[model samples]
Target: MPAVTVPDLTVLPRVSAPGVAAASRPVVSITSAPSGTEGEGFPVKRAFAGVDLSVLDPFIHLDEMGEVDYAPGEPKGTPWHPHRGFETVTYIIDGIFDHQDSYGGGGSITDGDTQWMTAGSGLLHIEAPPEHLVVSGGLFHGFQLWVNLPRVDKMKAPSYQDLRSRDVALATSADGGTLLRVIAGDVAGLQGPGSTHTPMAMLHATLAPGAELDLPWRPDFNALVYVMAGDGFVGPQQAPISAGHLAVLGAGDALRISAAQRQQQRYATGLEVLVLGGQPIREPIAWAGPFVMNTRDEVVQAFEDFQAGRLGQPLPHAEVGDPVG
Candidate 1:
């Protein structure tokens, strides 16, 4: 496969959302994305849960990984790790990812697929590109969201949900310009295939030029928008956010997102965005690496449990080639 070229996004000026009229339901705040890496050597642009995890409520972090081109012979993938007291949601847009877990869970998540893993009590897993893909080179793009469990569900048993693209519900507005795919919540009464114990909405939408969406949302949920592949106007004042920026919606009756044209007419091919929201847990969060609990003692206990081999054991997987990094 040929090398994939990922463009570097330019930082834009901050546009305040609070000044917009209440009816517009302007954005509460806009958070810029910062570059980072995860796993063995997976590069990412982090949108939230960097400086502070409190403001995001039940959500911990959102990472934009890949859309990168890997040359043939490149080796890169996530090694083994443990997670507890929360869930990991991954949405794949391109390429392939191989998943293995201590529960003997193994599968391939291809393009437009989603993997929702609940590491309730404990889980040890590894997610990485297929050995062939890493060795032959390919395009990779996806988003991984960390959702925090409330105190009650923190110790529940582990579970997994793999949603294929064909099964995911896609809804288009009465007009032709807007399209939406509900992955975890309901859209137009169409429920997503990925179910969650937590109350939340995970929507993937694409808008044509001049198309817009004004969706009704609960006031109590902490709503946020991450521009995935294009620029758009957000909130009431219509704050402009380019690809890679994540906007946290302010208090309002609903959300207003419009497909916007750039000064030079960007997004000629259209735009894509991910809308996520969840109810606030309003409880103490004690987090250390992969463990999230109610207090420091629980965090220490999680570590102790891992040390005692309480986390599930990982099963062996067939490998075409060994990953390099």
Candidate 2:
């Protein structure tokens, strides 16, 4: 949960409170993420499970990687895989992950670090725990989100961005009861470091017990809130939400979340949540396995290209694991 922190939240820039005319978004739906296994058997929570694609336009998939503390030699990660027509955004809240791609893009990211890889056109990549981390064993927690690219940018040259925790825009609520780490897009005039292909905003927030956060949001971008730890209420209706839960919000200019007065000892710090939203693409989606495209033919072509070795090959120096799909 130590993605980013400050000695005193009051010293950070404060997010202005919404005006009286601002409309508060209502909770449209709340769903609990189902636990599952991914990559080389690492446990994950399918955060977008059971949610309609139309409601999640521009966002294809989301996996909440383990909050588990692993013993020596128990850590695991994804094998080399091919992707096309989308981007993968991996955020590490704790522990370390090493990433390498075929197009000469690779790096090791740790606590609060982020790796943004655009798989436009297609490329091969792998993600695994660093050797030291795997040998020593430790706590590993994070999230991987798949963002869909519009048809125009689907075949654009691939790119990578390594965003460190120190580069994130830090902000606090007016009362200084909540801390926000903006990773992408604009929040109350504060711009995040990560640049996105689509218009979107992503942030991680920690609210003190019993504190309330009324956040201003873009009326055009769809809104979603996922609780990473502790319990809280979302939207203006005060719907109860807890860890592993995702809340989809309706149209509005603002969002309201309130943390419970008491929390379990494990989460005494506050309620941890990831808030994200993007302008809906509103186009037909054709997704399968690791590729996301706008038509069935495009998805088929992606698979064919990957199988024919057109995507790219693994680095000669790296160990190859089982294929993702």
Candidate 3:
């Protein structure tokens, strides 16, 4: 990706939301995505809780991302769940994530790890609790993104991309305080580790308090940001954000973010943001729980393949789980 020269910051206009005051200078818009039934109880009810569904084109769902100070005993996570016709991208900023799948795929993802899995043609999987996280805690958080599939590949074979922290390409700012790592696609002369089946870009960025960044936009795709930690400002809206918040950006050349942290503020230590975008596919969708496909026939085909023990045939490492006991 060619580096787009950073334009000089001048006359920055600040837009305002209801609660956020628009300070006509460089500011960030921060809004809390409401949580419903999914985050009812547990150490952090909203830990796994997120904004339910995104009723938009090219975007089907968005999770505000989540975090929980692991405790002695808590509901580790979701049991065996199923997904089809779409892709799930998991990015871990800190802590550990244990995952297993009926496709014979299972492993532990550590800090700064990204797992991009495509549940094409149907697949059953479970993300077991990270027992170690229960004791140690230091920025244990991440996001799970669901990208809809185009009709052509809705029934494509399932696949996975396990990206280690080191595998991603990272670039340090000129001042050396800000770090940008492209987890997928390309940015700043760097490319992400995981190979994407779709045209997508996912990045993990950390800005030291007081640092600022201006990111270029992809004209062909819709862009958005999810705040992982810190209290900062982002975009032309200049929204003030807290941790675990999601901010969708409008179409433009590039977006801007500020890492203005105050001494007295708690959780104000710069900002952690996930920038993502992808070519939107306006295709027919058939979704049911863990299954998603272009047509009902495709969904039925996937189910029949799994029931007849044929789905696992393609994945040599797939471990067939108990028959929905």
TM-score of 1: 0.86
lDDT of 3 by residue, 1-325 (tens): 1111113312212221112332222222334655532222322213222332332335555554346564455434555556667888777665666777767776887677877888777777766456655555434456666777788777788888788887777665544556677888866446778787778788877777877766555566666676667867777666776566766665555667777656225554467777777777767777655566778887777666765665544433333332110
Candidate 2 on 184-208: residue-level lDDT in tens?
A: 9998887999999999999999999
RMSD of 2: 2.2
* Each model's lDDT: 0.75, 0.89, 0.61
Candidate 1 CA-lDDT value: 0.75
List residue ranges in candidate 1 displaced over 4 A: 1-24, 49-51, 262-266, 314-325
Report the error of model 3 at residue 80, Å: 1.7
Off by over 4 Å in 2: 314-325
Ranking by TM-score: 2, 1, 3
Per-prediction TM-score to the true structure, in the order listed:
0.86, 0.96, 0.75
Which lDDT value does model 2 have at 150? 92
Choose the strongest candidate by lDDT. 2
Cα lDDT tens digits for candidate 1, 24-135: 4567678788887777777888878443666688888788887688889664677677788899988888888888788766688876788899889988888888878977
